[model samples]
Target: MCPVCGQEVESIYHALFKCVGAKNVWELWEECPMVIGTENMDFSNLALKMLECGTPRDMELLIVVAWAIWCSRNLRVFEMVCQGADQVWNHAISMLFDFREAVKFCGLGPLACEVRWKKPQVGVFKINTDGATEVDGRWSSIGVVIRDSRGEVAATLCRVLPGCFSVDETEALAIEARIILVRELDLHQVIVELDSLLVVHQILAKDFNGGLGHIVHGISGFLEGFHS
Candidate 1:
């Protein structure tokens, strides 16, 4: 049962874009590029298309709207509280305004920051991974991209994991999977990157305590074989 509306099975796309609650919030931004009746597009494709076609301000608002939807979903799922569409819209707008103001105050120009890829050292490969979960905790996926020193593709892996209770567990599972891949390929010297700071810290700490402690412990053992 979906936590928000108790309808169809919850998925990342549905939770973020297509649910009744999500649709209401998007309709609030009728003038936004994403709400212009684009059909049959998944969340990842929609996000990429927005980045390709949207202006800087459009991009900012789009990100805020997505975040607002996620926050609203969390509130409903965790606290059994539902926020109105207007409230969600207002919150996203306020957040975007504050972000823009902060950028101006710092004299860093209009956009917040642009992220790009950097190559690893000559003998090392880099593995980047990220995890996503549905708001209702019904589904989850992990993505991994491996690149060599010359910035050439090595391998890519994306897999759906058994449902978990929290996103941190999903992230920890992703790191564990990436380590397995490294071991299978006999890649002794490598650098792993992930967006979850907590997972990185846990891996570096070499001590594990949490729902993901067992997974992190496995990763710690794998790390011991690599040359520092």
Candidate 2:
């Protein structure tokens, strides 16, 4: 039986593909493909399936992220250390980032919403970003959504970083993360729509010497790449 879910027997494919985003949905549903193995396949077949999923870059990231997810599962089952999905995904991304120095290395659902959201202009994508700081002030969780002109969800990300940051800083981090996400998706001609008015002013004014100096500056650099 799976230590995490306890309802299903975990296999190699399950352990590797049931990534962080699907962690929450694991509790009640079998609908998440990432959380539930699509077939009773062995390792060779699993690799073959992954290769057919996305672009070459996506394949690399899948391998790296899968390794990190497997490690998190082991930690939870053996050491009894529990981590939120956001934290797990953030750690996996860091691992992928570091591996590139040694050797070049690297969810689902059209996360929909009921609330009314405005779509962007033709050929452009609008990305909305938000973040929440932990009550103890030790961690921050970020959420982002990207939608094309047609209002179709392009991509979404939620990650947790270990830090004690103010509202603006957390918001800035959220913006920074989408930079990585959009680039990986090869997205340009974008419009960033953030909830933090301060972050908006700072970015528009090109002012980066306040509390969010480091992250804000990096975000500015990333904006230069867009077709907007």
Maximum-TM-score candidate: 1
Q: Estimate each model's TM-score.
A: 0.52, 0.49
* 45-157: candidate 1 lDDT, tens digit per residue: 78678878777778778778888889889977785656677657756765565566656756865454654789999989999899886554456799999899999989999
Taken over the whole model, the C-alpha lDDT of each candidate is: 0.76, 0.67
In lDDT terms, which candidate is top? 1
Model 1 scores a TM of 0.52
Tens-digit lDDT string for candidate 2 (105-197)? 111233332336788999898999898864333566899999999999989889887764555677889999998799989988888877666
Q: Count the backbone clashes (under 3 Å) in each candidate.
A: 0, 0
